[model samples]
Target chain A: MIRSLAELKAQAKELGPRRCVVAAAADPVTLQALSSAQKEGIAKGVLCGPADKISQAASKAGVSLDGFEIKDCPDEEAAIVAVEEVRASGDFLLKGHLPTSSFLGAVLDKEKGLRTGRVLSHIAILEPASLGRLLLVSDGGMNIAPDLVTKLDIINNAIEVAHSLGIEKPKVALLAAVEAVNPKMAETLAWAQITQMAARKQIAGALVDGPLALDLAVSEEAVKIKGVKSDVAGKADVLIVHDIAVGNIFAKGLIYLGGAKACGIVAGAARPVVMLSRADDAETKLNSIALGAVASVV
Target chain B: MIRSLAELKAQAKELGPRRCVVAAAADPVTLQALSSAQKEGIAKGVLCGPADKISQAASKAGVSLDGFEIKDCPDEEAAIVAVEEVRASGDFLLKGHLPTSSFLGAVLDKEKGLRTGRVLSHIAILEPASLGRLLLVSDGGMNIAPDLVTKLDIINNAIEVAHSLGIEKPKVALLAAVEAVNPKMAETLAWAQITQMAARKQIAGALVDGPLALDLAVSEEAVKIKGVKSDVAGKADVLIVHDIAVGNIFAKGLIYLGGAKACGIVAGAARPVVMLSRADDAETKLNSIALGAVASVV
Candidate 1:
C-alpha cells in the first residue's frame, strides 16, 4: 500500500542504514548516488575500486569520502573484490562503472559468489504518476530469453522485492497482450500455467493472474469498461513480462514517456543488487539505492 | 500526414462513398451507425437482416432507413447474405449484431467470402491528443496467434491503411516490449528479422524497424535520452504488435486511461472490415466507418 515513491523513500529511511559495497566505485555518478544515500540515512557503502580514483571521483562529485571506507584494489579487480565483500557481510552489491556482465560474472561465480539457488533477475520498480502505486517489472536487464522455469524464478525474485517493500501479498500480473490462453501466443500459455500454479499454492507469497493488458492490470475504469472480473484487475504490484524485451521496453517507456520514476535492482541473490543505468537521472539513482537498502534488510 | 481522426474523417468524405455490407443489421447501434454514415455520405450500406426488425431498431435509434438498401432475410441468414454482398462489391464489410465468430467464418470462407491472399488482421488507429498523429495498432481484434508470415501480412495491411491516410512511406515500428532482440523473446526475434527484411527490401512499401519499446518508437526525446538511433525511433506511423493482446491492451489503455480517441478496422482482406464493439461509443463507431470508407477506396 505504499502508493508513491516519496512513501517508499520514507519507508527506506524508517528501515535505517544498510551497508552497500560498490564495484568499480571510481564512477562519479555512482559515488554521488551512494553519498546521497548515506546523507539520507538509507545506505552506507564501501568503495571497492582504486582509492586514488575513488577519491578523485568523490572530489569531482563534491562528495566527502572521509567516513567511507575504500578497499583499495585495481579497478579491474573491484567487481571480484566487491562481490566477495558483499557475500561476506550480506550487504548490498551496488554496481558502479564496471560493465554489468563483468560485475555479475563475479557475483555468479560458483565458489565465491552470492547465488541462492535462484535466478538473478533484474527488477525495475516504477511509480507512475497516474497509476498511484509502485509497479514492478522484472528481468528487463537480466535473463534475455528465459524459458518457463526461468520465468518462475523471475516472478519469485520480484515477489521477494515486493514483499520487502511491505506488500505482504503482491499481486503479480503475468502480463501478456491479452487475458486469454491462445495456442499461438506462448506468453499467454505460460501465464495460464503460472496462474494455475499460483492457485495450487505452487507459487506462493503472491496472488498471480494474467495474460492481462497494461490497462486491465492497472486501471480500475478500464476493468469496468472491459468488464474483466479479477482481484488483481486495476491493482497489480508486479508485472512479470513475457521476456527481457517486453520488460525492458515497458520500464523505459514508463520512465521516458509516461512521466514515471523508477528504481532498479538485481534480485534472487543472497542480497539485493543496485545497478542503475548511467542514463538514469539522479533521483532514479537515489531511489534505486533506497530500494536496495530496504530490500537488503530481508 | 493525416495526423488527426478528424483529418481521417475528412479524407473519407473526400473519397465520397464506399458501399458497406452490414451483416445482422437488426441492432439499434448498428442501423444508427449506418444511417449516420449514409447521412454524412461516408458510406451507403446494404443491411441484410429481418426488414421489420431492422426498421424497428432504426426507429428506436432515430435513424431513417431511406437510403441504405435492405435485404429482407432472417437474422440468422443475414451474415451469409451480407458477406456475399460485400464480396461482390469488393467494398467494406461492417459487422452489426452478428456474433464475431459467425461474421469472421463467412469472411474467412475459402470458396465464397472475401479472403485476400493475405491474412486478415485488425488495426486500431488512435489520434492521441498528445501524440498528435494517427497511430496504428494491428491484430487487436482479429488473428489470435499470428505466425511471422501472418505478422508480415498484418504489417502490409497497416502500411496500406497508412498509405490511404496519406503517409506515402509509413514508418512501421514492429513493437515489442524491448529494443534488444533477445533469443528468448520471440517477438523481438521476429522484429529483428522483419527489420532486416525491410532493409533487404524483402518487405517493401514501408520503412520497418524493431524491437522498439513504445517510448523509443513515439518520443524524440526518449530516442536521444536512450541514445538509440533509428529513423523509426521517434515517429512511427504504425505499431505492428506481437499479437492481439498487446494491441488490445495498449489501445484500450490509451483510450480509457490516457484520453485518446480510436477507430478500428480489419485489414489484409480483399476489402476492409469494421467491427465496433458494443462498448465503443458513438463517435468511435462513426470514426471506424470513416476509416473503412477511406481504406475501401483502394
Candidate 2:
C-alpha cells in the first residue's frame, strides 16, 4: 500500500516518465509544474499551445521548455489536438491554461474525444502528516449531484484508481452524517442501498461500508467509543462522499484545516487527467503529476 | 462569551440556584449529579420518584436528600409530575432515570406539557481547548429531519440561547458542505434561503451566512485563503446544521476527533431541559445542567 505522498512519488519514479499531453499549456504556473515533473523524470509532455508564447510563459516562470515537444496551435485548437494526442498514443492528458469548459468539452467530444463510456469523476488524494496512508476523496471536481447509478460509477472509478496504485483491496467508506439508514437522511439511505449492493458483489475490488460519520470513517477510537460494528469502521482508504459539494468541502477542509498535502486527478476516462488547484503548492502539483504517471497505466 | 466548561461552571455558580425538576430521579447517577449541583448552589430541584427507593439510591451514590423536595410518584407518573413541576414553577426540567420516550412524552403532552407551540431542538455547546469561545451546534438530538421552517425555528432557538448567554450579536453559520449556493446541492440551497431570511431580519439577533464548510466557520486562515466575504465567515458562534445527522455527526466528530469538550441541552421548550448522554463525563453533565439554567430564562 502507498502510505505517504513520498511513497507515491517514489512509485511514480519507478513507473518512469510518461507521454503527458498538455492541453492548451500556456499558463506559466502550469508550465513550471510540468517542467518540475519533467525534471524529476516522472513525466515528459507535449505542450499543445502557441509554441512561442508557451516558451515566453515558461521563461517568465524561470522554467526551460527544452527537451519537450511544443505543438504549435491556438488555445481552442490546442485542446482538441492535445486530446487527440492522448487518445492516439499518449499515456495521459493534462489540462493547462484552457477554460475548464473548453478542455472538458474537447475530452468529451463524441467522435474524437477520449471516452470509455464511463462517467468521469475527480479523485483527490490527501496525505495527512499523521495518517500513515493516503486518503482518497472523489467526485469533488465533477458531477454536481449524482444519483445512485452515478455514485456507483464514482465508487468504481475510485476503486480503479486504488487498483492502479497496486492496492489489492481498498476499504471504502461511503460518508454520510451517520451510519444508520435513516428515512430522512438521504445520504444514509443511499449509502445503505449501495453498501448492500457492494455486499452482493455488485461493486468489487473494494471493501465498502457506510453511511459513516467523518470520525467513524477515520478514527479507530471513535469506533470503539461509539460501539460501531463494521468492516470498514475506522480504517477507510477511500471516502466516497454523497455529492460534489461534500467532496469538495471535505477535501479542502482536510487540506486547509488539517494542514494536509493534496493532489487531484480525473478518473474513469481512458487515461488519467492531471488536474491540480491553481493555488496548490508545488509539491502538490508535482504529486498530482506523479499521480497522473501512476494512474496512466490503467 | 463562555470560554470553557470550567468558566461555564463558574458562571452557573454566579447565577445562583434555580428550581430544577428532575423526573424519575431514583437512579443513583442522576441523584449523585443533581446532589452535587445542589451542594454547589447551582440547582434546587424536586426529585419525582418513589421516596424510599430514591433515598436508598441516593444513599448508595453517597448523596444526601437534605433540603430538597421529593414527589412520591411511580415511574409512570414521575415524568408527568416533573413536567407539571416545571410548568407550574416556570423554571427548568431535567430528565433523571426515566426512559427517554416517557420523559419526552410528558414534555410534549397537549394540555399539561411544557410545549410552547415551538419545536424543541437540542443545542450542543463545544469548547475546544484551543478555541477562544464556545461553538453552538443545534438540532442534533431532536427534529430528525426538519423542513426549512423547522430549520428556521432551530436557528431562532439557537439565537435565543445566544442572547441568554449575553451575546448581543452572535454570528451564525448555516453549515453545508460548501459555501456556494449551488442549485444542484439541496443543503446549499436551504442554507442560501435561510441566509437570506437572516439577512432580511426575518431571523433577528444574529449575523448569518452560508453555506459555509466547517473550515470557513472556524478558521480565519481558511476564509482568507478561499477569499470568501461574509459576516459569519471564520468567526461563527453558532452553527445551524442541515439536519439531525449533520449536527449529530459534526458534534461527535469535534468531540471524538478534535478533542473538544461538549455539553448539550434541549432548547425551544417553555423551560430549558438537561439531556446529557449517559456516557458523558461528570463535568460535561454539569455543564449541560448549567446550560439548561442559562437558557431556561430565555
TM-score of chain B of each: 0.96, 0.97
Compose the digit string of candidate 1's lDDT tens values, residues A54-121: 98998999999966878999988999999888888747989899887898899888988888999999
Residues A180-292 of candidate 2: C-alpha lDDT, one tens digit per residue: 78888888889999999988999899899999887789888768879999899889889898777567655664565445688999998888888765667789899999999
- The collision pairs in model 2 are none
- Calculate candidate 2's fnat: 0.25
Model 2 scores a TM of 0.86
Per-residue error for A132 in candidate 2, Å, reads 4.3
